[model samples]
Target: MNTLLKSQLWRGLLLAICLPGVAMAASIQALNYSSREVDYIAVENPGNTNSGGGGDSIRPYGQGGSICCFTVPEKWHADLKVVVVYQLSPDPTFHRETVSVPQYPDGKAGDIWLIVYEDGSVGAVVSLYGPSRPEWPGKIKGYPVPTKEYRDERRKQKLKREKASLLTVERGLLLRGNSLPDEKVKEIQEIIEFQKKVIQSLEGNP
Candidate 1:
């Protein structure tokens, strides 16, 4: 190893050894790697009054804002784990899981991340660096990347939103009756036609 690398290793070891009783506080954040949308992710940090974390909803391949005040030991323990409660959208129910924290290569402290993987498996990780950085220690590398299923699900959501908007517009036009100008009426008709075609195309998609 080079001079800087060796220095960092020694520093990490020293902190873990010298600060055995020290506790490091880190904020909790959610990273979604699954195709489904995730929301209401609550982490139960035992003995901490601010244990309720993860209210932000994270889209597929996205990260939610961090919640404050969870503490971790200066030194890693074999049984370190967190209790995560979350809900996947359209499911109408919440899930509770106990996720074990992955080992950090350097015994340094950082923020806690609750990850929802592609296969629906969940895990927790601590990193001084973000997943995009090389220093991040985890089985998975890099931030969440969109999958084919995720793209399809997004398209379906867009179609639903558009259809709802179209219904509102149609209702408005009906209420206005012939009071709408001829040119304005024609423009609205053209837009409705275009939207219909778009909706049809999306609905037909597998």
Candidate 2:
């Protein structure tokens, strides 16, 4: 091949190799700002498998981790929209809302976030920052204020988890205590007593 023709062919090959990488993939994540827990949340777009992602057990005012492998074009289009399907805790029925893909800042796409609002409405935003960061693009600021009932529920859950952890530790101590010397076994027993008292306190006993 001629020198100029060979150079042109190599340039074309390099562009082809880099073009796919320019279409970057963004992770799909769910942020729940509502009082209710989200049992599940999913993003769907017709005929676009790369736009499909979902997550489950997203707590109120918390993020449910990211589902990967979704892409958003650098340029915005009028027809770009996605369907957000979600189910709240204790609700067997699922609900869906159609939301437009908001423009990414600087005309570049980042992670896609599906935000569940306090009034059960869903919103979409694309940003490199998460909800915990100040630069988060979601309209809801900070987190959902913890209601009394929510606080109580979290406290109960914490108590249950701590009690279970203490029980496991106590079991391990008992297993090792049998092999220890008399003084060591006595110390272990004292520790066990303290753990029991803590458990009792967690259970609201006087």
Candidate achieving the largest TM-score: 1
CA lDDT scores, all candidates in order: 0.79, 0.74
Per-residue accuracy of model 2 over 3-65 as CA lDDT, tens digit each:
999999978755553465355566787778778889988887755646567655688877777
Clashes of 2: 0
lDDT of 1 by residue, 62-151 (tens): 888888756676667888887777888878688778877877758777888888888877777887888889887766888888887777
Superposed by TM-score, candidate 1 places the C-alpha of residue 41 at a distance from the truth, in angstroms, of: 1.3
In model 2, what are the clashing residue pairs, if there are any? none
Question: TM-score of each candidate?
Answer: 0.67, 0.61
What does candidate 2 score on TM?
0.61
**How many residue pairs of model 1 clash at the backbone?**
0
